[model samples]
Target: MKNRTKIALLLLSSFGLMACDVATNTSPKTDPNTTAQTAVVSEASSSDNVTKEKVETTKAEVVMKAKTTSDGKLILGEQEWVYIPGLKESFKARVDTGATTSSVSAVDIQPFERDGEDWVKFKIEHDGINSDEIELPVERWVKIRQSSAEGTQRRAVVVAWLQMGDYKAQTEFTLADRTHLTFPILLGRSFVNGVAVVDVSQKYIQDKHKE
Candidate 1:
């Protein structure tokens, strides 16, 4: 009878051990998406303002093929002309990735002083489509570059504040006749510096239909 009792106790202990093993061996149950989201949040928190300031780009070198302006105008890499919403028309323009100043075609360039400050008054046919009337603005002119244009063709231009797709930049444009050119707006290297990167292979990535 003692031997039977010992056998019975051993069996009970063995069963208890098996039960403990079963409890500890249970698999972890958690949502995969939740786990991934947590990891993403952690990574974002760890990184500095660099992650928060600009649009998140892929790990692989991201080339901005196309982008839209703050005014919702679509633009492409190295696109020559951009539609001005205010004018409701397209102008002849060029994208000069090397030029540091934005050049606009202007004619009848004149300068004057207003309110005891230097200002310029020039006329440009707003958008080559709708209005025939010229856009005349008298704004303060700051000479940032003396020899901005190509070689001996240096131009004196006025600086204006420009907004492109949540990016604001001051660009210098000259009043010159660019009517002969295919595009009226010349986006110089200066304008493209920080706001854009040129993909020489890609053109008109934004609006395919635009000329």
Candidate 2:
């Protein structure tokens, strides 16, 4: 009887060891529904990021389309009519973005003194026609390098009031001989920096200014 009891206890211990080993080796089952939900959430987050990028790109495009600023400025073309209040005349102007300062056609440019201040006398000459003699105090002088001529030429700069369409402002112009050029007035970046915008494809976008 003692031997039979000992054998039964050994069998019971073996059965418990086998059950514990099976539990340790088995892996927990994953729920298919929960996995599907997680994938959907990740996809949605990626889509939202893409949408935000598109919104930022659209705002930049809008600013580019609205070329004009809040102040009274104009969208100028490759060529426009510019009126000079000092000369009381208007001339065809070429809008050149490459030039740093504006220039006007002048001839017989001579520097003099008035009231102990430096002054200059010159006449606008273009297409072989000479204008009336005009005198003004020289604001400054600038040296320009000519592509066709040797060395740099010294030009006299003067302040002048300009009118184009509805926009009007006082800007500096370097007096030079532009008789050989097609346009007498060459509008440069200084004049159009804050006053106008240039569109190279179009020409004569603004109407001729009237008195």
Candidate 3:
């Protein structure tokens, strides 16, 4: 009877140890909820990249036309009529983007003093040999270095009203000996860059004022 009781106690202890092993045998399982959250975060990151690209494209399109028209239409032909309100005169002007500063034909330049400032008198002779003496305060002087000239020619600079069609601007101009040149006035990039677009094939496209 003693041996039988000892055997029965051993069997009870073995059963309890088996039960504990079975409870601790379960390994960690990957959570389905966590995998779903990771996928959603990945999708959101892709969406953000697409939205950023769209914004950049829109910004570029909007800024592309900044240097375009301002107050009025800025279009010009190869040659057009230019009116100087200060001089009450209008003349044909050649649109030249190649040149840097606009020029007006002048001859017999005589320097003098006015209001304690440097002034100059120049004559403009056009059709039928008609000449008009223009006198104005010399704002500044520009040095002209060209391939055709023997030396640097210093010319007088002045601001004058230049009108074409409906566009009018008080733009800077330099007095030059343009008698040898074809056109009396040459409109340069200073007036063309931000003010006008030159169409090389067109000429005299703007309306001319009548007397």
lDDT tens digits by residue: candidate 3, 1-211? 9999999999999999999998899778899999999999999999999999999999987654332356655667899888777566778899989988898888898889988998899887565344677788888988888897688978888877777776778777888877777788899988988777777876876767554
TM-score of each: 0.47, 0.64, 0.62
Compute the lDDT of residue 111 as modeled in candidate 3: 84
Residue 97 lDDT (model 1): 65
lDDT of 2 by residue, 81-166 (tens): 98887777889999998999999999999999999988899999876557899898999988888798899988889988888876
Best-matching candidate per TM-score: 2
Residue 73 CA displacement from its true place in model 3, Å: 2.9
- Evaluate model 1: give its lDDT: 0.59
lDDT of each: 0.59, 0.87, 0.81
Q: Which scores higher on lDDT, 2 or 3?
A: 2
For candidate 1, write residues 27-115 as lDDT tens digits.
97899999999999988886755764454564322545336545544444566345554445555455776765567666665666666
Segments of candidate 1 deviating more than 4 angstroms: 1-76, 126-154, 161-170, 207-211
